[model samples]
Target: MSGGVDSSVAAFLLAQQDYDLSAVFMRNWDTGDESGTDKGCEWEKDWEDVQRVCKKLDLPCQMIDLSQEYWNRVFEPSLKQWESGVTPNTDVWCNREIKFGALLERLPAPTTSNKKPWIATGHYARKSWSTTPNSPHTRPRPKLLRPSDRGKDQTYYLSSISEEGLSRALFPIGHLQKSEVRELARKHQLHTAERPDSVGICFVGEKAKFSNFLSSYIPPNPGPVVDQVSGKTLMQHAGLWTFTLGENARIPGMKERMFVSSKDQLSNTIYVVPGSDHEDLYSNTLRVSDFTWIWNDAIPPDLSTPQGFRVDLMHRYRMHSVPSTVRKAETGDLIVTADEPEKAVTPGQIAALYDGDWCLGCGVIKSTSR
Candidate 1:
């Protein structure tokens, strides 16, 4: 439950419904804070909060240590992606592997044979249930829907989750806005009612910057920063992994500000452009691999056909979506052609598709055509 207000509220809401429930607090990262005195260190404080809320609600709470699982499953793969100069969505893996996969499996078995135990979370996403299925085995269809709180909707992080895992998932607070969640927390006198929302990566302390945290794991590898247009060496960089596409490039002597346009992982070099509107930073088409269709497990649209299968595409969390068409390429990869060129569509990041309120599918962007 992350010891946050949303999760506390979620538990309270579920408890109010009179369903037998048990709270689980996952310890994904140790944070290496042995002293436990670091003010910004969230592990100890978050655990205490979880205990407080569970005690107040008269619910049994257990701490599951999944630090090694997180390191092997989520962090290691992400480290390799960054080292290879591709930005991976680590949270997506965390939700799919740890939260839904491992934690759900560890839940106590149901008391009755017919009653299936479900795992509840603070994720701001809704599920629409339908008894009529597309086939015999798929009797009930659980469609992932956008929560009432648009800004806080977390379906993007959960795009890679499987149908079986989603079937046993519940998000009690998805119907309520963030403001209403806090209000409900206050009404219930929960300890997390006034706690500030945690920010950045879960392992990184609140006071530490993401760059600083990353530097510890990835040693500095010096490389040249080149201009994409002129092919001229502009400056030297500490590491290729330090920069992200579309972020500012603070060159020492250059008067005009530049943005990160691209990177060459083979040469360990970074490429930059003069401005945000640079031609090198936008893409009209992109190739995606490791695609998953959450709604229907059918073959993707054929690319040879006339621009069929229209869907709204999102490149990142909370980013404005653009109209796009999905088609299967001859190489067995999914190709997405946007109606409008998208800026800084980075490789190794997730690209999600939607139809109205339902999230259709998502894929890992392999490359983009600038």
Candidate 2:
């Protein structure tokens, strides 16, 4: 449940049904064990909130420790990506690896005649089954769709989920707006009716300085900061992980503002351009490694033909999808050509494709070209 209003309201709506319902809270962080003076995520408070909401609804609740799973599946890989100066979306992997990957495996087997229990979450995404005769398999296939509230659509985060994960998942709040969910909680007098929405990364959200949190794990590697326009070294940087592409590069004694243009790991150098809209900061082409289609067997036939299939591409979670074409490279990578140049299309980010409001799937961005 994550002890949030969305999940609380979702459980409340599910309780009105005849199916047996229970809440399982996964504790993915051990805040006290970290060396930082500042204790990390306050998971205990969130757990308490989950307990309070579950008690009022009379739903059985259990907490499971998934710190090891999170570290092995999501955090470790993300750490390596960040260390290499790439912005990997750990939140997206959390859904695919933890929520759907590990959690799905931990669910108990069905006992009664009515087996096959569906897992429900508060994610603002909708799903529907394909009823057409040309469906992938004889059985209907599940399609991940954007929620009713377009502003709150979360299909981007869920674009990497497997077919099985989407099929077994149910989202009660997909059709409800954020305000509507809070109102439903208030109308039912739920304990978490007034609780504020969560912000930032999952477990590390409470950390004041993200660099401080990361420093606790990765050691410092001093690097040279350089100017992109002129081949001149600016100054020494603490670490490449401190800055992100397209973010302000506050170098001392610079006449004008600077923004990150690129990072060269081979030379351990960070490159900065004069302004935010510098041509060096934009890219119209991206090479994605190992693109995964949700319906693997039902891949659009046109994608394999002479003319590449057109799809909307989105690398960041909140950003709108851009018109793009995808074609299979001889080396097995997927080449994405955007109709418009995209800024901050950083490496290690997952690029998701969509056909209208339905998310096709995603792949890790290998590299970019202007």
Candidate 3:
């Protein structure tokens, strides 16, 4: 449950429904402070909180350490992506690989034939069923829907999960708003009622910033920071991994606020342009690889033809989707061109496409064009 209010409430809701249920705390990372001193791991505290909540709910809970799995599956690939000057969204991989893939496999089978074992999570997304008669397979398909809580919809993060994994998944609190979740926790006297939301829990804890966590793994390259327009060196930065596209370039002794325009991994240079509205930061086209479509295995024929699929592409979580036309590139990668030039079409980040409220698929952004 991660000792969080949302998860606690999710468990409670599932229990109240009288479904055969059990709790499992998946320990993914080992953040034992790189110094190797007596500083305890934050996960230990989280584990304790999970144990307490499971006890309160009168549910059997067990801990499964998946540090190696997480390292191999999520962390290593993320570091490689960062090293190549592409910002990766590690949480997407975590949710698909560990939470749904590995942990779900460990869940005990149902004792009765009538009951089905499902791995439920606290994600703010909903799933619906539909049938596609026009397609080759005319069976019912599970479609990933946007949550009723509009602002809290997390379908973008979960776009990469397979249809099979999603079929066995359940999101108990997707229909409720964040306030309602907190209220439910408070009403039940759960310990996490007042606990604040944990941001970026996949890579780092509440105390450790992402830059600090990344710095521990990737040593500073100390490269030059250049201007995008003039190609003139502005300053020196610790490393290319330290910053992301569209983030402010906080160069010491600089007078004006500037935004990151691009980074050259070969030259070890960061290019910056003044102001958030800089034209260099926006891209008209982006290439995406490692595509996963939940609805259909093959790309829609229209996308391959001259008449491309008009889709809304979401590159980052919670950000509004951009109206775009998606087509298959000659190299087999998916090419998406925004209707209007969009800002920070980051490489290695997931490009989640949608048609109206239904999410079509997701892919890793490979490159962008200005």
Strongest candidate by TM-score: 2
Question: Which pairs clash in the backbone of model 1?
Answer: none
Which runs in model 1 stand beyond 4 Å of their true positions? 33-40, 112-116, 131-138, 206-208, 299-306
- Which regions in candidate 2 have their CA more than 4 angstroms from the true location? 35-41, 131-136, 206-208
Best of the two (2, 3) by TM-score = 2
| lDDT score at residue 115, model 3, on the 0-100 scale | 50
lDDT against the true structure, each candidate:
0.84, 0.87, 0.84
lDDT (Cα, tens digit) per residue for candidate 1, span 80-168: 88878899988888998899887777777877666668899999999988643333445667878889999998999888888888888
Candidate 2, 1-370: lDDT as tens digits:
9889989999999999986788989988766567453243578888899999999999999998888899999999999988988888888899999999898888775676556667899999999888544344777789999898878888999989998889999999999898999999999999888998778776667535787878888899999999989979998887888888898888889998889999999888999999889999999999999778888777776776668999999988778789999988888888999999999889989999999988889999999997
TM-score of each: 0.93, 0.95, 0.94
Candidate no. 1 TM-score: 0.93
Q: What is the lDDT of candidate 1?
A: 0.84
